[model samples]
Target chain A: MKIMPCPLNGPRNISEFVHGGEVRDMPNPTTCTDREWAEYVFYSDNQAGIVTEWWLHAASGYWFIAERHTVTDEIIRTYDPSEIFNQRVEFSDETTAKEVGA
Target chain B: MSATSPESLSKRSFVYRQLAGASFRDIAGGAMATGVAEGNNNRSQAEQSALLDLSVLPRTGFRGLTAAAHLQAAGLPIPARPNQASVTGSGELVLRLSQKEFWLLGALSDSGAGVDALNQRGLPAADCYSLYCQDSHAWLALTGAHLPATLAKVCGVDLREASFPLGSIAQTSVARVNVVIVHHQLAGVPCFSILCDSAAAEYLWESLLDAMGEFGGEVIGSNALL
Candidate 1:
């Protein structure tokens, strides 16, 4: 049986997971043109080489990313998304503008 | 999270009638019973070492970033890794299915009050998580000296005491169905609780029985585990 190393669950049978497709940066819908958005959704660099992709552990429902070689079917590494995307947008709790005439 | 009603779409165990034999009574919203099979050797195995149907046992499911915090606030200790389990002071079992998903099984201990307290304190400010009753799965508890041997027939993971260990859980397949296997103990002996889709209960049950036939597998009452 093929084994896949899960970042959180350790190594497990490959069958316990689902391929989540290539991991790519999402184009900002507000600024990107229709053509760019369409390409982002439909196009992929299918050449045989190392690629980063999403993978989901079916039983645990944990989703993460794995870098693998297409030609060798070798997984180089697996990691959680939070490790790479740590910065998040948060609304400021305090107001920026001062009261004009209290 | 608001308490959701049990889903009508949820399935009942196909072995329900078989499980509802003598001494069976209505509990946990399902038929309950306990007894040894007549042909089985009582001297061979300790009492309470048998298969228990916990399909009707109440379960709560939760997932997302704030879920662990939410459960911690509800009184269940969040396991540091996926496929790990923790027990509440009141005997409730909390199993982390994945990085952000968990299931709260058994009802003796409750963090409902803690959830209420969290809500009162205005925690979980956004829609950062989700929680609901898990009525879609069937559960069975397997215990006895022969448990590992029986499980070995179907489960691919090593389940011996030294390897699987107590309180550990695995997200693996058993009898061709994806399930969660938690290694627990009953009367100081190793026990495993198998959770799978309710619709496949009968098939899995029969498969387990087939595997256990070599070691005198028999259906015992829910009280054995409850």
Candidate 2:
């Protein structure tokens, strides 16, 4: 059986994990065009070489980032999301935007 | 003497329907199986290989960025790292599923007083929130000598005592269903405590029993464990 190393639970059977799409930078919803937002939410680069992607360990409900080689289907490394997200992200309200515009 | 019936309890086990022949007694606000038949070899069966339902027992969890600090402030001992567990002085099992998530399991001897106390206290910090494991997960205990071998039939993890060790936790799939397994002991008898989705309780219980049939494992009551 293929094994995937989980940042929180150590090595486990690959069947216990679910692919959660690629890791991509988010375009500020308030400033980016609708098209840009759509692309961010719906598209992936699908690169041929090594890529960072999201994975979920179904049992623990833990989500982490994994760098894997697309062509060889080899998992290079896995790490906790905390390494990338140190602080919480907050979205500004429409009223705040209007106040700024005023 | 007569024992309480599960049908009479306000709270019942997720697999209560499957416990038709077992004797029941009040515990943790629900009916727990005490024996299958009077004068039967339930204790012996448990010492060899047996499965016990603990779905109605008290269990609670907390998670978020500040959960660890919150639990520590409440005077509970926290594991130093994720996927580890610590037994409390009062016999409660504290499991650190992740850096920010901890689950408290009430000790059978106290009928879950430790967990219930924490649940009653409520979450005081906004960064930490309560996890309703009592309602969302079904708990089961597998005991005795053949636990590792029986689990090997359906689980891919290496649960042998040498590798898994006491207090080690594994969040993995068993029989293709998600489950959290903790290597723990009950009344000095080593056992594995399994927590799984409430909806899959019956299915997993039957699956485990089927896997254990070859080793003479059978359903046991909480009396055997205590």
Candidate 3:
């Protein structure tokens, strides 16, 4: 593994991370006043994710997200966890992990 | 998993009918004493490189017990009321008290000096509890590119620098046995070395080997060391 450290962040060690929570269910901001949307946007549920959840690669020295399967441990996906929870889950039927090498 | 070194039995100072394999030798003075000498890369002493030897000084809480002879024997960590240690890089740092009870903790390297200072008990030692260190050539070095992600499979113990930081030592169970795990750098890549009884080597090996399979990782013996 080639180790590179850029002040702006190419990448950092995984050790400096904390699995924050599952990004889900935020009430749209425009639908409500500031307070209601503020609470929904900041907090998320942490379900122990024995299967999967949002992992804050806090130690990444950068802000990124890691989507991993808890049981098989094959990383289901890695994205910006913070923003990922906000992105839509593209539920598709293109089964088998080998299909798309994301 | 590879062949386990025949469990080596010998006379030593700590009072406890304990099996000292390559893993516990550092504290048992069998292998642990020479730990610093065997693999001391001066530059990374504090930088926290891969696979570190850690020791915990226990507080006599809970029900702490050793074999018997090693109870107060010279040169053993003052018996901390505890059972085994365990963990990898990503899991919890824990110690077993009974079948289910466990405590999470960590510290620096093994303190043989402190153990050596235990005042010998004065009871006419009945079948004395002996401290036997294993001399088998079973040493461990962890190798991985995604160790943090890999470690997440077994434990919820945070591996990030902010939560665990550098030079972190943890005592926990991986696959149910006691282990001492430390976070280290492998060519700047975060890696971890978790040590437990060599008898449990096969079990750990299988788990790690299984974990690495996803990454096309292969296991190499002593000759193919990292």
Candidate 4:
């Protein structure tokens, strides 16, 4: 049984988690070109070595970040999304005011 | 004495249809199974190994960036960290599922007063929103000495008393169904309160019973827990 360590709940069966796409910086939807937005939404680097990705613990509905080896499929480490998402990303046509974490 | 029939109640358990031969009682405007036809000693059976449906019991959840603060402001004792639980003076169990998500389960004796009071107070803060736990999930209590072993057949978590001690909570898959398992006690009997999607309640209940058949597990009622 493959195990996925959840930042919120402890390690659990891999079956309990859904592999969200690779984590990437979002291009401001209001400013970026439609092609840029499409690439961001529909493409993945699919790196071969260590890569950061999004994972969702289905039971708790908690999403977190995990670093794993693409070749070995070994989970290197797992941590809460707050580690990287310190600011709330806001996309607006009038103003793209992002709220930085206090 | 005759008990209330589930058909007469406006609110019924999600698995009420599977409770044939069990006597029912009124609880928080809903029908709760109080006893089974063959279980002459349900209390003892609960002490050994039994499954009790608590779907009609009062339970509410709150989630948001400020949900914990909101609950604490309401005078409820929130757990210091996620995946932990605290019992209130009135016997209500407060479970902190995440940094901002908390679930409040009313004590059996209180029916629904504790949760009702909190719900009535409303979400006075922005971002803090009330969750429809009562309508969205079905609660089941798996109690007794053989709980860990029986659960082992279906769950992957280390639910042994030593590993998953009292007050610990695990949100994981059980019998391939998503469930939140809270380790607590009811009337001094160790219990794992399993909460799952209401739509899958009957399926999960049946699966649990099938897994527990080897241990002489029996169906119990809420009265046994009280």
Q: Candidate 2 lDDT, tens digit per residue, B31-124?
A: 9888866334357777788888988779999998889887887789999989999999888999999988999998988889888788767676
> Which residues of candidate 3, in runs, are more than 4 Å off?
A1-102, B1-139, B185-190, B222-226
Q: Which scores greater on DockQ, model 1 or model 3?
A: 1
Q: Which ten residues in a row have the lowest lDDT in candidate 1 chain A?
A: A93-102
Sort order, DockQ high to low: 2, 4, 1, 3
The per-residue C-alpha lDDT of model 2 at residue B42 equals: 59
> What C-alpha lDDT do the candidate models reach, one value each?
0.69, 0.89, 0.39, 0.89
lDDT of 2 by residue, A40-59 (tens): 99988998999999999999
Against the true structure, what is each candidate's TM-score?
0.79, 0.94, 0.30, 0.94
Q: Which 10-residue window in model 4 chain B sums to the lowest lDDT?
A: B35-44
What DockQ does each listed candidate score?
A: 0.41, 0.87, 0.01, 0.81
Question: What does each candidate score in C-alpha RMSD?
Answer: 7.7, 2.6, 18.5, 3.9
Query: Clashing residue pairs, candidate 4?
Result: none
Q: What is model 3's native contact fraction?
A: 0.00
Can you write out model 4's per-residue Cα lDDT over A1-102, one digit (the tens) per residue? 898888888889999999998999888766778799888999888889999999999999999999999999999999999899998876563543332321
Candidate that would win on DockQ? 2
For candidate 2 chain A, the 10 contiguous residues with the lowest summed lDDT are A93-102
Minimum summed lDDT over a 10-residue window in model 3 chain B is located at: B55-64
Runs of candidate 2 with Cα error greater than 4 angstroms are: A95-102, B1-3, B38-41
Clashing pairs in 2: none
Clashes of 3: 34
